[model samples]
Target: MSDHFLMFVPTDPTWQPTKADAERAVELFKSIAPNAQTIEAIFTDDVEFHHPCENWSGVDCAACGADLEDWFYETTDKVYRENHFADLSVTTPCCGLHTSLNDLNFVWPAAFGRFALESMRPGLDTNEEQEKAIAACLGSDLRKVWIHL
Candidate 1:
């Protein structure tokens, strides 16, 4: 059969998704998990890497995304500047597997390692607890947990 893939990205915060960031994320994901038939990622707000060295205040305002109508500045002699800014949003992602549970467990641990623990928290003092936590993260039929962020 053909390859299967799964990806879960955060709902778009802004109305726009840039080509460069999407391409970059896809490339990064491929380099790490090549056999992945399904890949998911959370959509996060665009990060501004550096400040533009230009005189265009409008450009800076757009890049930072400040809404002027939301903010106003007043000075002497009845001078008022209406500043508009951009709004920021957040996105979170998760992925699913179409392979056997064992295969998924193997690949996921190796690929995630430390980061996995960071994402998945539990009191893994023994095998029973470890399995339980894994099931919870995977939303298996073992048990249900109400986790708070």
Candidate 2:
């Protein structure tokens, strides 16, 4: 992987509808379906480890549709040998590492890189700012070194 990642959005509305809402809950849900569908479209291909290609020389693989299985397996092995079982479990499919976020196009590293984008949250008081802060917390240094024994 080239250390690039993408961001994904949730298809379903995370919050519940309030009483007396003009649009029925079902209609709102139906509306969100398209957004979710778009998200899915973004992640059409797996983030695989590929050799160099003609168009993008020196790039290991196409960031959009690369298969991450090898990387995941190697990473799992490396972490296991290093005795990091907890991290290993988190990366495993049984743990939902691949589909955890649902949207596939969001590159793991790039999406995670949002935190490293800045030293601290730009705005901390507002809800959006707070949410970004939280994401930054989880995003920084999400990468792990693959060790071979």
Candidate 3:
């Protein structure tokens, strides 16, 4: 089975939380999801993209149903050393089409010191009440993204 995570990010993409903010967010997450863990938000130039697929599987071109193995290989020189959160775009060799890596389906493990909370099982939807609670705790508007890995 794949793991699912819920990331609480600021409504503004460029906003980075301080250590105290991270701690408060952790507490807020823990109150809602007892198993929540806090990751500090780190500043990065690249925009983070998340894939919603299970276990990195099911990544195929939209125009043509082709696997992304070759596309991934051709796009990156150092495959193993590449940061999973880096900004990327995939040009489908099959159809000669291009798409943002973020637009593609994939699970993104929230990193770079961002306050991320994870739930291992699927279908654990965070209701509006819980979201409001978290927002109140953090004292800011937040956006939630689901990542299935």
- Among these predicted structures, which one has the highest lDDT? 3
Give me the candidate number with maximum TM-score.
3
In model 1, which range of ten residues has the least summed lDDT? 107-116
Model 2 segments more than 4 A misplaced: 1-64, 83-127, 133-149
> 115-136 in candidate 1: lDDT tens per residue?
1111122222224554444334
In candidate 1, position 47 carries an lDDT of 18
Candidate 3 Cα RMSD (Å): 5.9
- For model 1 the local lDDT of residue 80 reads 11
Worst 10 contiguous positions by lDDT, candidate 3: 105-114
Per-residue alpha-carbon lDDT of model 3 for 1-149, expressed as tens digits? 55666766655433455667657766666656664443334345544433344534445566666776556545544422475435344567778777754344332322222334334442456789988876776666666666665
List the candidate numbers ranked by TM-score, top first: 3, 1, 2
Candidate 3 lDDT (Cα, whole model)?
0.53
lDDT of each: 0.25, 0.28, 0.53
* lDDT preference between candidates 1 and 2, better one: 2
61: Cα error in model 1, Å: 39
TM-score per model over all chains: 0.22, 0.20, 0.49
